[model samples]
Target: MTASRARLAGSTALVTGGSDGVGLEIVRMLADAGADVIMPVRNRAKGEAAIERIRETVRDARIVLHDLDLARLDSVDALTAGLREEAAIDICVLNAGVVLLGDRRRHLTADGFELHFQTNFLGHAALIRGILPLLERSRARVVVQTSIAAARARIDWNDLNGARRYSPYRAYAASKLALSLFGLELARRSGRITVNLSHPGVVPGTAIAAPVRALLPQDLVNWAVHRVGNAPATAAQTAFDAATSEADAPVMFAPSGPFGLWGAPVPRAPFRRFLDADAAARVWREVDRLLS
Candidate 1:
């Protein structure tokens, strides 16, 4: 094993969305590094399948699966409650998300929030809050998987739920922006644990890109994605780096390739908009109020 992987031999990691795509790749890397991996998935079968796949390479891989639906606060709470009893959690990768590309209709979760906003941002905020104590105690590295879309998106404070106006891509971008802001703010507020943001670049075959299949010819899009986009394993490097690095402060990692599309992971500055302290604090307060 590489030195970095060897360092993680006795650590524990919690990863979300580990069933497939970039998430599955991240989980495999963690398991291969000898960390005890805990994956909270929305689908049990998929989670089991992911574990089986991981063990194919890391024959003695230690992995546990739990149920979690980011759209439901109750589910998030349940997972958090169980995790709190654990002795140590060295890493937490907030990576699960939903992206609706061509769909025009706005959907709400059972919690009555916009699907993207809830799944991508609010639920993660709640999970972070719920596990704050454990994180603090372990001094864990919390890696938040953000997106390139966040660079151009602006959060509509008035229409956070998309009740006033909505578009699939807009909603997705806004949710990512909110998540970016919250992650930045969390980094500032919590000195006990490290918080890092990772932009995995455009990974084409992943579920997040599935929506775009409806907008264009699937074959053409697939061809383009394969031609220009990074594969799931390649895209997962940014988050993997963030989770394992010993950076003391919050660092944003992204692809070093052109336009931040596909390349090796490197430390990059966050989007100019994400640097707004007031906006980050505002988002933090709003999430707290909503969760309360």
Candidate 2:
């Protein structure tokens, strides 16, 4: 086994959204690297298929699936409770997310929050809170998947739920920005756990690119994706590197290609907003209050 993979022989990783896209790729990489992987899925059939696919490449891959729906806090709580029984969790990748470009109308979760805000940011926030003890005990490497969209978005303090004015892209970007801020704050607050951020450079087949695919001609979209965007597996490398890195200082791993869209994963400076300590603290407080 490679040196990196060998280092993870006895490690355990919990990955959210591991049933598909870049999340699935991260799970496969962890399993191949000799880490036991636990994936929380919203669908049993899909989760089983993902495990089957992983076992195809690693005959003795150790993987477990738990039911989770990031849109619902109760589901997040159940998964966290089950995971608390584990001995240790060495790595946690908060990667599950949703983009609602397909539907322009505003949607709310059962918790009565904006769909994107709750699923992408708030739910993950709640999960982190629930598992903070495990993470601290294990000194786990926690990697949060963020997006380039976060750089361009700003939180609407007055309308966090987008109840006043709504747009698909705005809601999605805001959620990512909030998530990014939370990651930064977590890094500052937890000296025991190593917290890092990752941006899976644009990958066309992923949900984030669904709108682009629908609007462009098939051939053109394919060409653009090949020329400028990464494939899911390629994009996943950023998060994988962040999760396994020995760096004590927090860093944001992102693509090194042109316009930061495609290429090898490398450490990059976080966007200015991501470094706003005041903003990060505010986000943490707001999420805590909302979850409580």
What C-alpha lDDT do the candidate models reach, one value each?
A: 0.89, 0.91
Q: What is the lDDT of residue 271 in candidate 1?
A: 83
Model 2 scores what on Cα lDDT? 0.91
Q: Which runs in model 1 stand beyond 4 Å of their true positions?
A: 1-4, 211-222
Candidate 2 residues lying further than 4 Å off, grouped into runs, are 1-4
Kindly list the per-residue Cα lDDT of model 1 for residues 1-292, writing each as its tens digit: 3455666899999998889999999988888788899999999998999889888877878899999999999999999999889999989999999987757899999999999999999999999999999988999899989988888998888888889898888899899899889988988998888889999988878766776666788789968677877888888889889998888978888989899988888999888889899999999999989999
Q: Which candidate should be chosen as best, given lDDT against the real structure?
A: 2
Candidate 1 clashes between residue pairs 3 or more apart in a chain or in different chains: none
Task: Tell me, by TM-score, which candidate is best.
Answer: 2
TM-score of 1: 0.95
TM-score of each: 0.95, 0.97
- Among all windows of ten consecutive residues in candidate 2, which has the lowest summed lDDT? 1-10
Candidate 1: deviation at residue 122, Å? 0.7
- The TM-score between candidate 2 and the true structure equals 0.97
Error of 2 at 252 (Å): 0.7
